[model samples]
Target: MLLFSRFAPNVLLSAAVALSVILAAVMLGLAMDQRWLGLKLEAQPRLAIPASFEGLWIDAIEHDSPAAEQPGAGIPASVASLVSIGGPDQRSIQLTPQDLMEEPDALETYAGMRAFFARQDEIAGILRSIGGVELGVAFLGETQTYSVSPKHQRPVTSLPPSFWMQIGVGLAGFWLGAWIWSLRRGEWATRFLLLAGAGLMISAFPAAVYSTRELALPGRLFSVLSTFNHIGALTFGVGMIGLFLVYPRRLVSPNWLAFPAVILGAWQVVDILQLADGPGLGFHLAVVLAMLAIVVLVAIQFKVTRGHPRDRAALAWLGLAVVVGAGAFVATVIAPNVLGIGAFVSQGEAFLFFLLVYVGVALGVARYRLFQLDEWAFRILFYVVGVLLLLVLDAILIVTIVDERAPAFALSLLIVALAWLPLRDMLARLVLRRAELSRGNLFRQVMDVALTPPGRDQQARWRALLENAFRPLSVTAAADVQDPALIDDGLALAVPGAGGLPGYRLDYADGGRKLFSLRDAELAVELTTMLANALESREAYEKGVAEERERIARDIHDNIGVQLMGALHSRGLARKDMMIRETLTDLRDIINNASNPDLSFDEMLADLRSQISEHLFAAGVKMKWEVESAGPAILPLAAAHTVRSVVREAVQNALKHGQPKSIRVTVRLDEDAIALTVADDGSGFDPSSVQTGNGLANMQARVTSLGGRFNVASGVEGTRIEARFPVDIVRITQ
Candidate 1:
């Protein structure tokens, strides 16, 4: 029900109504038949004297037969006078043997004549004397005798069961199609349903014309029905054409065709009304014009599908329907009338055209996504043929069973059952296999790898697995080598035997490899390079740890040495005991703070400053400090300590030899670089003369090794030292 509502509500309603009407019609027909049966006892054969047969032969012929002297016996002059031929108001008519010379015309006229005689046999004597065949003749003087065959039976004119069935089917089909159309709102569905309904109404018009003459409908009703039919046909044509334009797969101009379509539709309706009484030249003209429009539409459809391959299948289906429908329409209109095959055949042909059109339209609208229509068609054909074969077999079985050949029927059934399952399975498997193949091999391989577990030593394992897997493709791969080493060694070795031809190498190893022509050699080189790098890195890490430990020991011994010795010197006396204890505490604190990894570079610098100030105050050297930084002070603790040591050494040098009155230390950051300068106003010495004795060379060497610039400019006025390093370098070391 939902499906019907969704896709074809109009169709559903039409089918329902058609079914009800069919049931009513069937019941009514049955009741009529029963009533007819009940009236059989009193019923007599109905016959009529044709009004046209009055004066032709009845006037001249006499008695029931022609006389010897006359070819047709003349009517008795007295009786003819009394009869007044065809009564006073009737026009005189004549019959001649010339009219009866043609067998077909004579037979038709004779049949009418016989019907007249049967209804009024009392006047048969006059009719026989005129044109009808005589049953007997009286002899008087020169008498003649004649005989006649019994009259042909008139055919029963009631509608056949098949005719009713056809009407029902057509009504149901049209209603179903209309209901489908009605699911859509407003003009679109209404117009289509109107068109379909008009077609059905038009179809019933001929039956109504055939069935009744006295109760003929008013001319206006017929005119309106005709107009509606013409309009509906026009609407259908225009709608289909509009659909072609609006939803085309390529360029289309609906506006270009719309005005003309409307004009053509109106013109067609006028033409139909004008020609409704009989076939006219105007009807032919309208048909020609409609054909031209159909041609133009088809041409446009072809143009739309030219560049759009996606629409090709749909266009093909539509084109086929159009061709078939048009052919059928043409055949229906011309074949029976021109060839004399009768009317029902033409109607059947028209019905076929309509059916084809419905199927095509339904497929185009609802099943267009099935682009493989040809495949579907083939499958349907195959199944239909298969089913037909099964039916044939089933029929044979039934016939055989009825004839007592049970073994034959059983054998046939067995054969069919045995074949069906395997055949269906084979077809399914073939389709699936083709689909799988179309997806490509590489995708399958990737899927396989994804579904598998990672191995221990996953990197090497995966590389080896890929290499082995790809071996079937003649691809040689190295899994664990660096690129440069592959270029330097692997390529040279791999290419020597191949006369210097280069080869391609895929680099899947840790650091990858250079291209190699020979796959085997590249794999070996890659693996070797990976192992070498790994071992080298491990060794370097171990060496760095040992060096760090030694450096820490050296720093501890150097910084704390003088303070420890001073404490040891004062250990024996009570007067020096307090000094010794204080010295020991300071030394221990410095050592412990220096060893702490978590201490930030700025905190270390502050500690260093405090230690230096304590030492300087103890030594009686006045210190002036100035520090300016643009951003954070981010020097590492180790580098900060080194800077402090350098500062202390400079101050000590100034105090010991230069007799400096005031010592100054300034730290400033400029851009990313830091500059630290220590200067004193004291008796200064020439830096060239001081040489390495002043530890200037040591300070310069320490700064140079750390990628910093250190300079000591000492003259007679004062000694100045400046050291500069990158903040990034300091942080990295920390």
Candidate 2:
């Protein structure tokens, strides 16, 4: 009782300890039985005659006491059934012997069986009350006297295979039943399974003792043991019926479970009192009915539990248990005997069939989690650790003993690297259900999330990365976890905040297929570290760019703006003239693009026309400039800089080389592109024959960098250059 009641807190440890106790009990029973029958005769004297014949023919010449030292009482396989015994001159257990054929009347057909089994108890009582040195034996047509005194004493190893096998059945049932009960102590199904196990042991244990007797046990002890065996059979049926009534789906209230036990107990009473006229009503009827009931209940459970996958799986396992557990016993033992056809094996050996049931159920409950999956997967990880130790041992052995072993280390590592590593990953994915993103892929994604700039959109991108990696069913904001952790038995994983990103709680991993394991937690830690580092690096880069931009703005104020402010004191047109010139120069410097520029295309064109007019007048060259455009008003710094620099260089080239009388600069703007044409009336040279200068190369490079076109044509009339820039393409590059 202490063994059962004290150990519910630690399920696995309790099961192992209780199972060991059951094994020890069975071994002790075997030892006691082997020593109980002290028979050292050369051959066994157990007689198994056909059930049809009934007589005891004991031929004895020396009539004092049976001796192991004398001669052997060679009992043949073919012998008359033993049915009569008496006191020393008083006939006490004599019975009529005949061969009765089967008949249509069921009661008449089994009348001899009923009479023999009913009076067999009384006959055993008579034999048990025998006095010292006195016994009697008789047959139908003859008389003889005999006794069995195994005074030479049996060897310690005198037990038969039937005894060991019977003990196995009992221990198997008892241990497996205790194991299931240990795991699910509060479950009604497991409790009934435990009861079934107790019943199996009760029947098998006592049958192990008397059924393997050398010659005979005392009649009273034999009768009590036989009654105990009947009790086990009765209880076993009741447990099965009650188990099916509630398991997978409860077909009846748990309160109604006692009715089957009460009914079966009453039926056992009738069998014991010989109230039933037919012989099959004793224990076999209960067994057959329980089996039929299990079948019917399984069918009903299948229909009722249609949408429940877990319950259906349990039902399949339990139904298989019934078929394997009780089916063989009926086939070989009870069914044969009830039909007046002799049993194929001894009743003790037939108990082995009952062992199969508990083994199947134990595998279902303990190893498979009712046959769903993912238990051995956890324990096998320890085995993988042991294998790692073995690999380390191999490396150490190679270093110490082998002459040429440097290459062997590589081979060993490669073997595990290619084979064991992948297998381990596959199992981790199957059982642990961690994210399968590769390290390289995850690093790239985390970098993208970090570079998304600081705002709500950046945080959203970070959250999106987590969703893609883990594929959790639901995500919600959570209080900050200092580190990523699995909570609620892996039902939810709490991810820590990294950089500016907030913590999140992820639930029901992989569509609720599995729980998070250490593998998943380790993966989360890796991702957190990566994201933190990437975000820190992006923040540092952006900070450096801002600091540099601040210095440039300061330089503009000190070196350029101060001189222009000094000239602002002049009056009238001169003051305003100086101011406009300072503004045009500052706007060109700003187009160096330290940060994004937001200047309109009209301001850019105004600056360009001013520069052209001033530069042409200084060169003593007449100018003709016109602007015709339709496009977005604001252009980014890069696109505006390209427009400014390209036009400035083209005008300088015509003034230096073309020696033009007059220059015409034409600009046309569209939504996606800007087109410019610079042509001069001068002594033009052949463009193909002349060496290209830095100015022409720079203008062409700027135009083509924005995915536009550049062209040049030269003749005696003048030199013409056309360049076009895709303004939208320039903005996308930024």
Candidate 3:
């Protein structure tokens, strides 16, 4: 029970850690997938409008019409008061009779008879009425008589409250969704989405308040809405500027474009302050300037998208949005006021156009991915919206077309909506399937080499993969075996067979041409050395086995021969037995130690000391010993074994080579380091002309491998051999 209790916490912690790691991996994979899709989508087409609208005009008012005489029948106060009277060549006159009265007699007649032009649609009505008159209207200084007949214009319908409410909710939902997505990554696109949404909300305020039924707080609401609208306009301008800076090729800097917009926006605020009594000329000028600025901006946008083929589709969609938005705004607001159109149609058309324009702008900025899904989505949106619009407009058109009833238009709209979805879906499926097939085929060819073994046949496969992987970028891979001459053809990828087998190289290119190669010459040399060592080890192992069998046979023969010779010479049995026992014991010990390599250094040292003590006691010589080391005495097994062997050999040499009378062995740590010293009082020889035997050479080699320094000094006073290995290098933890 206690064991289970103690282990449960650790088990739970381990599980938690594993779960966290798995979650992180899944999240990372999802992020990578999204990034991959984004890149693929970026390469697709864009939509935009062409740059042309140089000659267009709309009439504002028809003074000869009965609608103008009716109370509340003239154009909306906002539209009537702001329209310009003169053409671009002449200084613009206000929409007042006083300005016309000051003109010359010939000019006054023309000016008095001229229809006020606001939008393109208004021109038709004025031209119809003035067909018999000799006077002409001047547009950009060109005078021309009306060409179109007068027809009774129709009224525009208002959108339902429910539909607008739904639009508002959808916009709010989109913003919330975007904000949630941004909480994780906060990318530039996400920030742009949030900013655009906020601007839309601010811009919607004045329109919303103006439509409300409540009148008590109308003045306060208007003031608040105007402030918000002005601020929102400024923010939108700044956001566009930022967007251009970030994507300079896609969007031009609005430095020149924004100046006129800002000035006009300020003028609007001043005009609002003066209410209906604002300076008429100043007000009309501001409106004209604002329209011109918008036109210029749209033209610039068209140019940018046209020059870049990759941006064509996205720019196309965006361009449609701008055109529809701007067209709607101009047709409703400017056309009716300039050209003397009927008030009922003018106000209603203006609102409807404004709504359509708003939708276009929203889609352009926030829903770029809709374009990648195929043009079908746009076709669906356009036809569906357009058909419903036509039905609503059919009632107005019927008065001119054939005097149709309102019920027929509503029935047409219902039929169009029902047919739109199926057609859109079928088209989308056909387009997407073709796209998917091409993408899949390209992916398969590039990855096929990774599944196959790499050899001569695979070499071509790898080259194919490389070429396709960097498609539109030319690359060639030459094998060292077949194309040795081409190996150094600028790209230095080492030829595989340049030296021998089992070697390869890589080459990198800048653009389509070879830049440099990375060769594994050092790796090739190391592999060759390893092969040589393996061959040598096998040869030595075979020789060692054969020599061992021969040695065993020789020992058996020598023992038998010695026994026979001893019997003939009558040698002593006891001495022969002792010699045999000693030889056998030495053989057994050597075989046992070779098999058991983990023998401790301290144990070996103790054994050596015991042997030395026994021999010295027998020789009637006294020996002194001293030893010291830090902490618990521990040394690496290899170092310890080597040191012990050298010390024994030195002691034997002292007894046999120098004939020492007494020996003093000191093994103590020097300060914070390990030190071992062996000294003996013996017959010392000359310092020079001493030969180093095979045994001495073998001892030096062993110590050298262990990175220890060995020193031997000989003199008349005494002979000394010192071996020292750094304690720091030799010590090991228990």
Per-residue lDDT of 1-734 in model 3, one digit per residue for the tens?
23333443324333323333343333223222210000001011122632221112222333443223333323321111222322323333322222211101112122221321122113222222332212223343444432222223211112225224423532442332233223312333333434444444444433333322111112333335444544543343333333332221434343553443456567656644544332233243344444455455556655766654324434455446534654554455444444434122322234344344335433532333321222333343444344434554565456566465666676556655566556555654553321222445544542443333446654465455334432213443334333222233323333332212233344432332222212122332333344335445545777876865654454344333443444456466654664454345434434544455354445655765775676566556677766665534555445554655576556656766677778877665443344456778888766456576434564676567667777778877677877776544444337
C-alpha TM-score for every candidate: 0.31, 0.46, 0.32
RMSD (Cα, Å) for all candidates, in order, is 25.3, 17.9, 23.9
Error of 2 at 112 (Å): 6.4
Question: Measured by TM-score, how close is model 3 to the native structure?
Answer: 0.32
lDDT of 2 by residue, 1-734 (tens): 45666554344434443554465465445335321213222111244642333443222222222332333452222232334455444645554332111111123224554443445445434444435112333234334444533223333345668777877787668666655565566777777887888788887777876666544444455556656777887778777777888886888886798988888899878766657765476656766666677677778888888876456656777767776678788777777756766667667667877877876675554322452223443344324433554466466668666456666666666766677777766764564433457878888889988888778988898888888777788889876678889885465788886886888998766654444545567788988999999888988998978965764674455435653664575465654675467555755566445655556778778877876787687568998887776544777665776677677667767877879989988888776777889898877776666556456766776678778899988888988889887776423211
Ten residues in sequence with the least summed lDDT for candidate 1: 34-43
lDDT of 1 at 676: 82
Tell me the number of clashing residue pairs for each predicted model.
19, 0, 38
Q: Order of all candidates by lDDT, from best down to worst?
A: 2, 1, 3
What's the distance in Å from true for residue 487, model 2?
A: 13
Cα lDDT of model 3 overall?
0.41
Could you tell which candidate, 2 or 3, scores higher by TM-score?
2
Candidate 1 or 2, higher lDDT? Answer: 2
